[model samples]
Target: MKYTKDHEWLRVEGDLVVVGITEHAATALGDVVFVELPEVETMVAEGDEICVIESVKAASDILAPVDGEIVEINDKLVDNPGLVNTDPTGAAWFFKLRLDDLAVLDAFMDEDEYADMIG
Candidate 1:
């Protein structure tokens, strides 16, 4: 998985890309109560605020890691927002993106770099 400075993570999955907030971000947010996801087919730009996660601590924007069109959102989040805290990098992913240009992902960090930067 690759990471963004804004605390979002993305990884290629066949024809699409999966997206979620980093574990550090989920932990910081406390228990998530609600998640506002972008609609399918929504066109988004790199760095755009495409989703919002509200937690006991505060609400935070989950930015698009690169330019893309949203293809799918985690419907499970509507009923189980706590998944953001319980399994952030797994089934709790916020969305899947059909990347506008895969090359745009070169701007992001690999897990090791992201870990050190956050540390």
Candidate 2:
């Protein structure tokens, strides 16, 4: 898993890239209550706020660490925000993007490094 200092993670699978908040992020956010996802096909730039994850404590922006077009979003999150707390890296994924620049992935932290940072 690759990560941003903001606590987002990206996983490349074939031509699509999956994005989600890291476990540390969810834990920090507390109990998530809602999520707002970008529409599919929306073009997003690196560092853009593409989604919002609202927890019982506060609302957090989900930034796009890579420039890309959103291809899919996890609708499950809208109905069950606790999924974010339960499985941040899996079922709670925010979106899948078709990246415009693969080089942006290099700017992010790797799993071990991210874990160290959060630890």
Candidate 3:
């Protein structure tokens, strides 16, 4: 898994890449009330806003960390957005990407570097 300074995370699983905000971001968002994800098969560039996560405190854009096609999304979030708060990095992952280039992940920081930056 890799993390971006914008708080998005990516995980390469075989041919698919999982994407979500960090636990730190979920905690800061308070309670997530809704989610808006792009349709499957949509093409997105790195840093493009592909979804919106609305929380009690604020609404935030969920960015595409790498150029890719959106293959799937966490439909569960539409019905139960709190999953974002409880499991931002696990069951609550926002979407999966068929990454354009796996090497793009290398541009991100590791967990230790991200933690230090936020602290």
Candidate 4:
């Protein structure tokens, strides 16, 4: 798994990539109440604000890890926001992308480095 200092995780699956907030991030965000996802087929550049996750305390922009077109989004989050706080690494996955540049994946932090960053 690749990670970001901002507490997002990316894992490649075939030609697509799955993205979600890290456990630490979800915990910090508190009870999530809403999620805003980009429409499928939307083109996103690396570092683009592709989504927003709103918690009871604040709303956070979810950045893209690679330049890609959005292929899918987890619509489950729209109805069950607690999944973000309860299972951030699994059920709370926000979206998938058909990445254009795999090299951009190298810009993210590794798990250990990201853990340290969050601490």
Candidate 5:
């Protein structure tokens, strides 16, 4: 798994990359109330706003971490937003991205580096 400065985590699964906010991010947001996910099969570039998350604290956008097509999303989040708080790194993953080059992931931080940055 790789982590971003923005507190997003990426896990490579088969040929796709799964994306989700870290536990740190989930804690910061308080209790999530709603999640707006992107459409499957939508193409996006790095930094594009792809989803919206509303919590007790505030509403936030989930950005595309890399250039890719969104092949799948966790529809369960819409019905149970608290899943983000309960299982952020697992079932809370927002989407799966099919990238042109998975090699681009090397630019992100490792778990140790992400821990150090947050500290």
Candidate 6:
């Protein structure tokens, strides 16, 4: 898994990259109450706001970490936004993206680097 400075985690599964906020981000957001996910098959550029998450504290947007097509989204989050807090790095994944080259992930931070940045 690779991490972004924005606190998003990217995990490669087969040829797709799964995207989610880190536990740190989830905690900062307080308890999540609603989620607005992007539609599958939508094309997005890096830095685009792809999803909206509303918590007890505030509403936050999940940005696309790379250029790709959104191939899938986790519908579970819509029904249970608290999943973002309880299972952020696992079942709370926001979406799966199919990028032109998975190699682009090399530019992101490793887990150790991410931990250090958070600290």
Q: Candidate 5: where is the Cα deviation over 4 Å?
A: none
lDDT of 4 by residue, 1-119 (tens): 89976688999888888999999989889999999989999998878998999999999899987778898999999999999999999999999989766767887888888877877
Stretches of candidate 4 above 4 Å error?
none
Candidate 1, run of 10 with poorest lDDT: 99-108
Q: TM-score winner between 1 and 5, please give it.
A: 5
True-structure RMSD, every candidate? 0.9, 1.1, 0.9, 1.2, 0.5, 0.4
Q: Rate the local accuracy (lDDT) of all candidates.
A: 0.89, 0.89, 0.90, 0.89, 0.97, 0.98
Q: How many steric overlaps are in each model, in order?
A: 0, 0, 0, 0, 0, 0
Better of 4 and 6 by TM-score: 6
Error of 4 at 104 (Å): 2.7
Candidate 2 lDDT by residue in tens digits, 1-119 = 78988898999878888999888889999999999999999999888988998999998899988888999989999999999999998888999999766666887788889989988
lDDT of predicted model 4: 0.89
Residue pairs of candidate 6 with colliding backbone atoms: none
- Lowest-lDDT window of 10 residues in candidate 4? 99-108
The residue-by-residue lDDT of candidate 5 on 53-76, one tens digit each, is 999989999999999999999999
| Shift in Å, residue 25, candidate 3 | 0.2
In candidate 1, which residue pairs get closer than 3 Å at backbone N, Cα or C atoms, i.e. clash?
Answer: none
lDDT of 3: 0.90
What pairs collide in candidate 3? none
lDDT of 3 at 93: 90
Off by over 4 Å in 2: none
Candidate 1's error at 77, in angstroms?
Answer: 0.7
**For model 1, what is the error of residue 33's alpha carbon versus the real structure, in angstroms, after optimal superposition?**
0.5
**Poorest lDDT segment (10 consecutive residues) of candidate 6:** 53-62
Consecutive 10-residue window with the lowest summed lDDT within model 2: 99-108
Record all residue pairs in model 5 with backbone atoms less than 3 Å apart, i.e. clashing: none
Best by lDDT: 6
